[model samples]
Target: MKTDQSLRTVIVTRYILPLREGGSLPALTEADDDFKYVLKFRGAGHGVKMLISELIGGELARFLGLKIPELVFANLDENFGRTEADEEIQDLLKASTGLNLAMHFLSGAINFDPSVMKVDAETASKIVWLDTFLTNIDRTFRNTNMLIWNRELWLIDFGASLYFHHSWDGWEEKAKTPFLMIKDHVLLDKATELRKIDLEFKSKITPEILSSIINLIPDDWLHWRDTELSPEEIRTVYFEFLKIRLENSEIFVKAAEDARL
Candidate 1:
């Protein structure tokens, strides 16, 4: 996770606008550091589990040398958005008055359209490998949850990654499952070097990296309200799921390779 101390405690200073484009209605907000961010609320949709996915998937991508906006642990106060005219947004802010996830907004970034912007084979293959490993099924051509900034590809919106977390059951089995969704991936055709990229990435997801990423999820986000598992147990579940995913990578790697054919 991007645990730079400045990111440790960013208080949301002002609400700028509601990004209604997303189902969760993530907001454009300014922080104490005077920087604008796209804030993902903990109280929205899938709630904290979404944030957890964002953290792990994004940090894992960064570790593997993919470009992503800096993610910060944003703090929101109870009355932060009370003055907003929209009642729905007001209630959302009130409910999300604690820890949340935010990405440094990429000003002037354009949505990535493959027709307009071409990606190299290696980069496309790595992204295919990353999404397949992360189980992110949202990167189809329709959505293409990727952006272009300064002529570089920057990944965004990992909330859809780690889909298995939605149920919080059968996690171990889910980890080793084949990610058959790669066939619909926007870059799958361009990802010609899937096997090579898999070899380069499989060993990079070490236990230490897994532990470091899982440990970054906060206790509040770790709470599974429907389950009796404590935060520590929940953290262990995350670590174990990812550890097994790393060990059993061949399943998804082959799935991606076959999908390209």
Candidate 2:
């Protein structure tokens, strides 16, 4: 969660175009700030929880010194959807006629190709550890979800990570659950120093940092029909779960190391 000083809110100025690659149907939108952003709708099939995951996952990456696009609170007016010719998009805009999440668009960025672009062992280890901590299942060889922008690798699309929140019945046990799918991570083969990376990060990510990151999530987004927990209570749950995971990161670190071998 970002501190109040770090969060920026922008109003949607124009709807540029739709990105058809993913199921969420994210749109390339222009904001009042005169900048382009990839807006993720709260009304998407994944619902507001997905936005929460995106907020946490992206901010966690930034906190760990990883490069990710800048995030903002985008305000979508009800009238913005009125001009859309597409019924589906109009419906989405209508449903999401409030605050949504947006990522600054990286113009002219290209998908990362591991064979052509070399990732050092240390960087790979850090990324792998981050993914393992978040239980991210989307950053595999098949869908990398990474881009080469300004000659640097940037992580994107974290709506699929932090999946434990989808089902809170046994979330405590699930937080410590082994991420078996990490074996297929795009950087797993190059992440040879998982223990070292884990050691470097374990202490840096304090409970305070986790709480701040979780705090960045808007209250409205945390309210879900599936559970009766209030927004603040839900934030506390995330903080506790992540703190427990940090304490138990050795398990995940060892798993990543074994997989690399």
Candidate 3:
């Protein structure tokens, strides 16, 4: 959407380096481009899941008021034969939004490791809160998915979130509170500041973005249900909850005080 201002569509050059740890393969785009992005393909018969996962992940990060890079759904014209599992997703977004939309290319943005920086407890607290709200269980010591850009922390690789959706019971747990990040939490000691964060950012969570995300959800993304919660419903729930939390940070503070007493 912001591509017209920030980025131009260019052919990716080649897979320069492979970040094999997280199933991400990094590549170089045409030489003139200033940014480099990662290309993630869909799994078998599960194109819908991949797209929805990105959409939900990005949207939730934005909703939580984090400094996340802009993400666009792209269509890679290069063909993998029909036997590949993600062919369905590849065909769908390509036809719908044209080939090659823009996305949050992480490499040019930040370093994946935070052990090298100096971050404090409060900032780490907010990071843990985001993980709890999204039910993301992957931000462990071994496989941290944080990207540091321009002295700020940006979140990435949320494929492991909403894990219960894939389970037989479906996503039944409501994400109400933020999680706690321990010393073992990656990026804890990194010298990252908690600036530019808008606890009140819920007000800016536009209807258009929410609609765009919901509209793109395919019919077969694992256990995601096309339930009664409309786009507006989801938007309202998120906004109201976020507003309450921001306006009432004191509520949590008081609870902590009472616990101490």
Candidate 4:
């Protein structure tokens, strides 16, 4: 499980500002390591589940050779953010006093604008294939959720992926179903190598790799709610779900290619 270096831990030093573009209320915060991060709070409206999705989705994208910011576990102490003038921000800080999810902040990155720049077929194909595997639904034109960092495309904001876990029911059916929403994906038309990329990517994300990534999910997040399943049981459910989905990737791979053509 690569338990030795699961994720680098950082302590939140200060909340620099709030980023309202995302519904999860991620903030620009400085960590004790002296690096800035876009911190996703467990106290946010989407709750800890969103953080879980963010962790898994970001790691999966990186595993597939996609460009994504480095994710970290940011620890928030209750004493932090006590002097913030905004009551809302103060409340949020108080509630998220434990481990939160964050990614290295790209200081000068700009939001991706398709009309201004274009992506190549293989890069687009890999992205489409990855999103389809995770059932990410937020990559449409309205909100690309992509950024241009150092003139390269970088993926971000994966809290919108893995939607099936919201209800935790019928995951097997959802895993096997075609993610028809790929039609709205910004890269759909440019993803010309889904067939070839599918073969390449499926070989990369094996059960061992999946287990290592799944092991990164924090126990507190898994048992956040009063669900009947223990944290370990919940983790097993996610493992099984992804295993089924990866085994059935061809369904969505074809669905995406069909949508593209």
Each prediction's Cα lDDT score?
0.89, 0.89, 0.46, 0.91
lDDT of 1 by residue, 144-260 (tens): 989999999999988998888778778989999999988999999999998788788876777777878888888888777678898888888888987788789899989988988
lDDT of 2: 0.89
RMSD versus native structure for model 3: 7.3
Runs in model 2 deviating more than 4 A are 1-5
Model 1 compared with the native: what TM-score?
0.96
lDDT of 2 by residue, 76-168 (tens): 988886978999989999999899999999999999998799999989988999998998898887889999999999999899888898888
Clash pairs, model 3 backbone:
37-105, 44-85, 117-190, 117-191, 118-190, 118-191, 119-189, 119-190, 119-191
Q: Could you tell me every candidate's TM-score relative to the true structure?
A: 0.96, 0.96, 0.55, 0.97
lDDT of 3 by residue, 119-188 (tens): 5656665565445444466676687777777778877766655443344222222223333323334644
Q: How well does candidate 3 score on lDDT at residue 193?
A: 27
The order of the candidates by TM-score, greatest first, is 4, 2, 1, 3
What RMSD, rounded to one decimal, does every model reach? 2.0, 1.4, 7.3, 1.3
